[model samples]
Target: MKPLLELRRVFFRYGKRSPYILSGVNLKIIRGKVYCIVGENGSGKTTLLHIMAGLLEPEKGEVLLDGKPLKEQLPRARRLIGILFQNPETMLFNPTVYDEIAYAPRQLFDEGETRKRVLESARLLGIEDLLERPTTSLSYGEKKVVALASIISYDPEIILLDEPLSNLHPERKRRVLNMIRSLAAKGKAVVITSPDLELLDNICDVTLTLSEGRLKEGG
Candidate 1:
């Protein structure tokens, strides 16, 4: 099978004065596996993910999804990649959880499909009871679940999760990991970037270290 995502000698810098976060990062990600990228706080994991998601353009090298350059094939890339940022605020805007969960799908799919997708995703994430509640009224963990649900509503083939367990309770963390495991079982490719090795080692198919911009496999 073709790799879902490929990065070749990629480099990215935040701005002119800022140092490069990702330098010569390269990898091939396959489907039906959970990949964990772990490193210290300043590691380039998030930068690398942003490039793969097409949210930022790399200054050097290229990101290819299913054989096409990311820049040239963003629609295809977007269709296959769903990113849930570390900051849950990046995904929320609507007053109610239901609207937020349904937002992205409504843009691409028909109404009936949108409703079905949103309901399923919300139920899977266990946010169905909070669907009519305001986003601001929820706790940090609730917002995280909602953000993840919104990504599920998109139903991308590859899921890019940045610190999904951050600031979450042990119970909630376990629940989220179980949900991710289920996704991986369904043949979706999941690339999770976190500093928590224990969580990754326990649930992920592979573990790697990201340091000084290089992703070393199975560290």
Candidate 2:
């Protein structure tokens, strides 16, 4: 079967004269599998995720979704992929937690369906009680959960989580890990990025190390 998403010989950098952050990086994301990318602070893990999510265009190679160029398949690609930024605060802007999670669903669903999606996502993240709270009032970890719920509410086929375990309490960390596993079990292509390999143990089906602008198997 064709990969759900594929990056072929991708290259990127911030400026024309800047050194490349990603040099000929290649990856294939498949459904039902969890991929963990372990990299240092400047290893371009977030850049790779942005390319896969169609947020950035690679300087050289190409990103494909279901064999079609991601640029050309953007409309479909947007509906298929969801990305959680390294800082959860960057993804949260709505007033209440319910409004935050309901943002995307409300764009595509009716009132009844939107409410159902919002409540279900909040329930999945064990943040049902947080629905009424203001986004600015939540703790960092709670904000992360709320951010994740916002993504899950739309039921995208591919989920990219950046530093998901950071700032989370041990219990919340376990909850997020279990949620990743559940997403994979349900045939969603799950990608997580972390600096620490130990935190991702037993959860990822494939662990890749990103260093020196390349991606390699094993952490």
Candidate 3:
């Protein structure tokens, strides 16, 4: 079977004047597997995720989603790929947690589906009660869970999580990790980028390390 996602010689630059963060990188991620991209800080980890999720365009190379070029989207790409940023702050702007998680679904899915997905995602993340709580008023960790719920609400075939375990307590960490593993079991491609080697080791079936735009052997 074809890989769910493939990045072939992808080169990404932030702006016309900015430097390239990812250079000549090729990666293949199969469905139903958790791929942990381990790397140090400033290692282009998040950049790669953004490119794959169609949030950012690569300067060169192709990002294929099930054999279709997704470098800049051609209508079904967004439904196939979802991305969660490294910082929860980037996602928490709505009036309440309900609206925050409801945002993506409202844009991508029908009204009935949006409501159903938001509630379902909140419950899955064990934050169903926070639906009415003000998003900014939530604790840092709570906001993180809300961010994850927002992404999961989209029901994308592939989810790229950047630093997902950050700020979460031990109990919630295990819960979230199990949830991620469950995604792969359900045939979703999950890619995680983090500096935590031990956490990745425990959670991922495959690990690859990126450093200075280059992937380490067996990373």
Candidate 4:
């Protein structure tokens, strides 16, 4: 079978005036494995993740899924790829945690299925107790996991995480790591970007580093 996602000789920059953030980037994201991309701040890790998710197009080369260009397969791609951004809590606008987790499913699924997915996702992330609480009332860790629940509820095939362990407490960080491993165990393609490479050494199956606008294998 083809890889779940592939980035081939990709190139990107904000504008002609800006320096290239990614050049000749190539990667293959496979199912049932955890891939970690480590980079320092401003080294373009997030940019590459966005390109992989089809949120942004590369200036050159291609992002392909199942041997098809991602740009043409976006509608279907959205369901297959889910991205959890850094500081996800900052994007939470729902009144309650339940509403937040339910939002995406409600848009794509029937009411009964939406409810089931919301509850299931919350339970998976150990956030069931926070479902009825106001989103603003959640602690940072609770908010992070709840935001993660929102993505898991959608049941995407490929999950992209940006700085998942950043700013989280020790226990919350452990929870996030466990969740990543769990997702991979279920045959999902899990990709993560982090500045702290050592923290991820034990959990990732294939670890790569982004530096000087290129992605290199191994830390």
Candidate 5:
């Protein structure tokens, strides 16, 4: 099968004087697969993800979404890729949880479809009870769950989750992992970045390491 996303010889740096965070990085993310990118705190995993999500343009090389250049397919890329940044709750500004969850889908679907998607995603994330509550009133874990519900509401084909298991209780972490597996089962391409490398080894199909501005497969 064709890759859902591809990064070819990508290079990035914060600024002209700054050292490269990602240098000559290349990767292919396929549907129905779960990929884990393991790295230390300053390993540039987050930056790489931003490039994949089309939030950042690489200094060199290209990012392709389903065989087309991502830059050339911005609308399709936005519809196809869902990225949940670390502490994604920080990005949420809606008054209520339901509003937050329904926000993105509203851009692409009608009110009826958006409502259906929001409720379904909330149910899947076990946040149905929090729908009518104030988003600012939620606990950190609750906020995370709400944030995830929001991302999935649009049903993007490629999901990028950064530090998904961080600061969570073991049970919650397990639940998140299971949810990720379920997404892959439905043939979505899932890419995740985490410092906790060994925790996801059992479920990930491929593991790659990011270090000193480069990507290498395994461990």
Candidate 6:
């Protein structure tokens, strides 16, 4: 079967004189699978995720979505991909949690549908009670859950999470893990990156290590 998303011989660097952060990276993301990328801090895991999500262009190589070059199909690609940045604060911007979660849906749906999507996503994350709260007043963990709900509200085909378990309490972590499993079971492609392999145990269908600017199977 063809992959839903693919990276071909990807390479990236901040500047012409800077060292390459990612080199010769190739990956295939298929439906209904959970992929974990394990790496140390500053090992380019987040950079890889950005490139995969089309937030950054690679200096070399190509990213493809549904067999089309990502650059050529950016809008369509973005509609099908949801990404959670390592820092939840960076992803949240609306005044209230409801608005933050409804932002994307509001663009594609009418008021009624937008509210439905927002409420459903919030319920899934057990944060429905926080919908009326000010985003600025939420704790770090609350922000993360809200950010995740924002992505879930859109129901993207591919989900990219950067250090999703970081800073989350045990109960919240378990909820997120269960949610990942549920997403995968429903045929969504889920990719998660973390500096520690232990945090990814039991959830990954495949675990890959990023080191020396390349990805290798097995962590």
* Best candidate, TM-score: 6
Enumerate clash totals for all models, in the order shown. Answer: 0, 0, 3, 0, 0, 0
lDDT of 2 at 24: 92
Residue range 97-155, candidate 6, lDDT tens digits: 99999999998889999999999998888998999999999999999999999998989
TM-score of each: 0.95, 0.98, 0.92, 0.94, 0.96, 0.98
Return the TM-score for candidate 3, rounded to 2 decimals.
0.92
Which candidate wins on lDDT? 6
Ranked by lDDT from best down, the candidates are: 6, 2, 5, 4, 1, 3
Superposition TM-score, candidate 6 onto the true structure: 0.98
Predicted candidate 3 versus true structure: per-residue lDDT over 10-85, tens digit per residue: 8887788887788889989898988889888888998888888887788889988878788546555787777888
For 90-118, candidate 1 gives per-residue lDDT tens digits of 67899889889888888889999999998
Can you give the lDDT of residue 102 in candidate 6? 93
Model 2: per-residue Cα lDDT over 61-122, one tens digit each: 98988888999987756878999998988899999999999998898899999999998898
Q: Which residue pairs in model 2 clash with each other?
A: none
lDDT of 3: 0.86
Write down the worst ten-residue block by lDDT for model 2: 72-81
Consecutive 10-residue window with the lowest summed lDDT within model 6: 70-79
Question: Which residue runs of candidate 2 sit more than 4 Å off their true CA positions?
Answer: none
54 in model 4: Cα distance from truth in Å? 1.0
Q: Indicate the TM-score of model 5.
A: 0.96
Per-residue lDDT of 190 in model 4: 96
What are the root-mean-square deviations of the candidates from the true structure over C-alphas? 1.4, 0.9, 1.9, 1.4, 1.2, 0.7
Tens digits of per-residue lDDT, candidate 5, 1-219, equal 888899999999999999999999999999999999999999999999999999999999999988989999986669899988898668689999999999999999999999999989987877789999999899888888788888899999999998887777787777788899999999999999989787774888889999998999998
